[model samples]
Target: MELAKEIAKGAEEEGAEVRIKRVRETLPQELQSRIPLDKVEDIPEVTLEDMKWADGFAIGSPTRYGNIAGALKTFLDTTAVLWKDNLLYGKPVTFFTEASTIHGGHETTILTMSTYAYHFGMVIVPVGYGIPELFQTTTGGGPYGATHLGSKEELDEMERKIARFQGKRIAEVAKKLKS
Candidate 1:
């Protein structure tokens, strides 16, 4: 959630309209309430209509056993209709992931999620080397996408800058493609 917020903030900072929302959780009812939804303020539940409204997107998730969290994957699975219709084709999209450890499979998570964008025919926007912060970070944020390797409650300065840069880059690409 912190990743998404900062990404959206960065996109808006670059004059792009941004919406921060989450896909419906597929967690079992027994474990659903355990998630502190209020912790990630300002993110609304994402809907298919919302997906259709975006010019670009930054889909993020916490890493789970070297892959995306099940809930997010489940949500992505629900987009088959859009995939079939090619609703997201030509739009720009990027990915981000968070993990508990410094090497906690973040890069793989980003790669796996990129497949979804590929199936949607979306233009991929990588963070690349445009941001000097990427080279200076001891933790998350990479070419695959913006990343986080520590507490979700807070971010290191480097990670924050990378998130901002990734968001800005995504917006810039989306604007170019849109025009």
Candidate 2:
């Protein structure tokens, strides 16, 4: 959630309007009750309409077996109507993710998520070694997208910077496309 906020901050800095929404939980109620969700309870649930409303998007998810979390995948799977209408076509989209370890499929999760963007006809905006932080960080950020090591309580400075850069870059590209 913190990573998403940082990305949103970067977008806002780039003069883009941003909305941060969380995918609805897909876990069974019994299982959901065991995890603490209060920190994100107030964030509005993402909807297909929200996808249409945005000029660009930065999607963040936790990696699950080298894939996007089920909640986010489920949300993306519901976008057939939007896909049919080409509502997201030509828009710029980027991704961010978290994994349990340094080798915990962060890049793969981003790659897997990019398939959705391709099918939606959205342009993928990758980090792509454009920033020095990518070279310096031992923790998260990478060419695929901004990421965080899930073992950390908070993002290290480099991770935060990389995420912010991603947000700013996506917003800049979106603005150019809009104009």
Candidate 3:
């Protein structure tokens, strides 16, 4: 979602600011798809810094075994200090995932990620609209967060609309919460 980040940055031009963070894991194949496998050591420090620096966060991953990827889980595990200090209490957070197939358990991935946010005492924001794409999109975008259904098919216009809306909506809600 590198392209989506630019869109999200633009959505913040009205005064809401957002930043993107990447938490790399140790798996060679997966790390290659995301960051260099050699970069895994940087994940925890970067994650902690980002969590402390931002008022809100949006986490994304490719689901593994119907759950958040191991790398993300490892990063979250390093937040014990934040949890102990209640650093994340009441902050707003959302999650997104990419799945390999159509029924690749994206919703479950969202749920799994939500559990992490809950542990950190962050508020989970669900997609508010009842758009047909929530039920019909072949690619991604849902009330669960922004997602990408990985397959040969490209994202349709409706899915793109929903993703942009999701980013805007989350940023707006985060702004309200901060206020």
Which should have the higher TM-score, number 1 or number 2? 2
Tens digit of per-residue lDDT, candidate 3, span 46-133: 5677788887777777778689878788888888999999999989876777787767888898899888788877988776554567
Clashes of each: 0, 0, 0
Per-candidate TM-scores read 0.93, 0.97, 0.81
In model 1, the runs with Cα more than 4 Å from the true position are 151-153
Candidate ranking (TM-score, best to worst): 2, 1, 3
The candidate that achieves the highest TM-score relative to the unseen native structure:
2
What is the lDDT of every predicted structure here?
0.86, 0.91, 0.70
In candidate 1, the residue pairs with backbone N, CA or C atoms under 3 Å apart (3 or more residues apart, or in different chains) clash, namely none
**Can you tell me which runs of candidate 3 are displaced by over 4 Å?**
2-14, 28-45, 130-132
In the range 61-118, model 1's lDDT, one tens digit per residue, is 8888889989888888888999888899999999999988878989999999999987
TM-score, cand. 2: 0.97
Of candidates 3 and 2, the better by TM-score: 2
